[model samples]
Target: MDRTAAPGQSHTTPSTALAYLNPRYWDERFSEEEQYEWFKDYSHFRHLIHSHLTPNCSVLELGCGNSQMCEELHKDGATDLTCIDLSHVAVDNMQRRLLSRGLKDIKVLQADMLELPFGDECFDLVIEKGTMDVLFVDSGDPWNPKPETISKVMATLKGVHRVLKANGIFISITFGQPHFRRPIFNAPDFSWSVEWTTFGETFHYFVYVLKKGQRSSYEDIPVKRFEVPHVNLLHEELESEDFAFLINVDELNC
Candidate 1:
């Protein structure tokens, strides 16, 4: 079988990368990995995350996985929170963990981010850590990705946009650079004002703060209508540079 990797991201080929989108993969992974946090853990950016959150704000975390982000948030005084993940194993493990810890206020549900199971204008803040990046892993030609790639990413963003209340914020923590991520984020359809701050010890990780209805950048792509896209990923390596390069090179710029 022939497999190909994007210029800089050789960690996984496009063909194999598809497995990263499967729920079963995560189910098995979370069972064995014991405890793993994608990108930096909550402590690394707690101040930054807290800046956008209030003690009483309603929070929704997409692709909760096995990360302790929600637990940390609850400990810090934010209790009105719900977490969702496509993998039943991850949801089940997280639920059990929360229960054993005596934290019942936080709700963990098995869900897909592409089609969030929540009402519109319900959450004050919707956030994802490395959730949206999964949509782009197998996305060919990051500069000019395939139609389906755009569709999947757009569909998930639309769901996020739909569920957020007026002036609500969507926080995304990713290895995606501004040049690669902003167009989709700033699209006219989302109508969200975008601001970003980078954090990391060696290579910078982007934290995009999209304020609902702010519309700072105007992107005029054909809007992908709201739909339930069933796709995802979980593999993340600190994002090294040996994978791609300076010319027309991408794949999350790994």
Candidate 2:
């Protein structure tokens, strides 16, 4: 939780405060030789993704940021894989890595998450890892999100909703709690089934599985029965000493 700059890292400034919102910032960050992982890798959550994925499932990863999750998916028999990021630099880097490894089937592109170029209902799965959390950092207030922050997040969700096939699954691995993220998935046009798992002991994170359409038998339920409403709440479910389970009834219908 240290916000101060490290020995070589740049100091925070007005421009740098919301750097994650800018493509140039990510380009510069990924241009460095050292790789950084925001949270756990695909190995930790491979079962969750694989359980919902078919061998030939079309997968899309939003804001991939040089992560190797797609490569793992490819090795695991997912053939139609695509990854998108706002930074061309990151995309190029990923392309080179994939190419060097002979992973030609996985496609990498530079695109904004809010305005995905893909047609409607094209993908069987859309996966996000730490992408929305970056938006929260860009908002300058993780707890009290600004209007623009919510707008950008909603736009990205809408785009994901449009691109996913009926019953397609969207899995997001994030540090955000259900209270902060559930409303974004509670759309009237689509019914959703959501479940979350907690990882790590002291510094925990959550993996949220959001399935489109009515609650299905394939979906996993980890928590006791509860409903998730659409209304925004201040400081709700923000503090936790031990890991907890929360569900959105509006989405889970359980």
Candidate 3:
């Protein structure tokens, strides 16, 4: 939980790459049973999810961690709840808590998010909290170099696109520049759209409530033609990477 960046290091990296993959890391952090500081104060996340969640609808949580908010969703009448976490210990803890409380029918998966082991169009709602930042911070993950900051963000959105039913909802909270707002409405895999925003605390958090609606009928929408001015700087860096152009941005020239 080293929260501060190293001196002279403008970028922040995850303290543990694949650390959650290790059961001990999760077991230690969650065993304390105190609510994580971030979750305790953020009711906006819960409100956003509740707005999109329907009674008896299928839901999936990406990077659920040890958050108990899923139970809250269930209490609000969410049916067919499934959660994915990279940590076995975290999943085990969730399962045990559900069982102890006599809860039933929640499915949990312990797998890496970059490669979700699930069928297509399976969920009606996919929710995430601050996961994009986590992906960028995981510098040592072998999945790929610390994702081009925004590349992993787009990939996560793509994953949501694949697993969501037509008209399914994707509710995510993101922290970054205003430019990220532009893509949620135009990404080709699904028709992206906005829902809301809140300039709260230290983060300019945007609540992007995307629906897995029909992609434009035009199949010839070329990816090469999509360009932002600073994309050229990333040509050499991300050229060899599989997920290119997922995150190209100007560094604000500050």
Q: Estimate each model's TM-score.
A: 0.80, 0.76, 0.66
* Best TM-score among the predictions, by candidate number: 1
Q: What's the C-alpha lDDT at position 121 in model 3?
A: 91
Give model 2's clash tally. 3
Candidate 3: the clashing residue pairs are 14-137
The sequence of per-residue lDDT tens digits that candidate 1 reaches over residues 1-254 is 00123233222222344556666667776665445566668888887788778769999999887778898888876789999999888888889989999999999998888888999899989988877777765676666787987998898999999999999999998867776677788776878888899877755678899899877423444434433322122223322231111112233322
**lDDT score of residue 117 within candidate 2:** 97
Distance from true position, residue 165, model 2, in Å? 0.5
Weakest 10 consecutive residues of candidate 1 by summed lDDT:
238-247
lDDT of each: 0.72, 0.68, 0.57
- Estimate, for each residue in 1-254, the C-alpha lDDT of model 2 and write its tens digit: 11223245542222322444566667776776323444656777677677877868999999887677788888888899999988888889889989998998899998999899999999999998778776665343334567987887889888888898998988888867776666555645446677788776555678888887756444332333344334222222221210121111111111
C-alpha root-mean-square deviation, each candidate? 8.6, 8.4, 9.0
Ranking by TM-score: 1, 2, 3
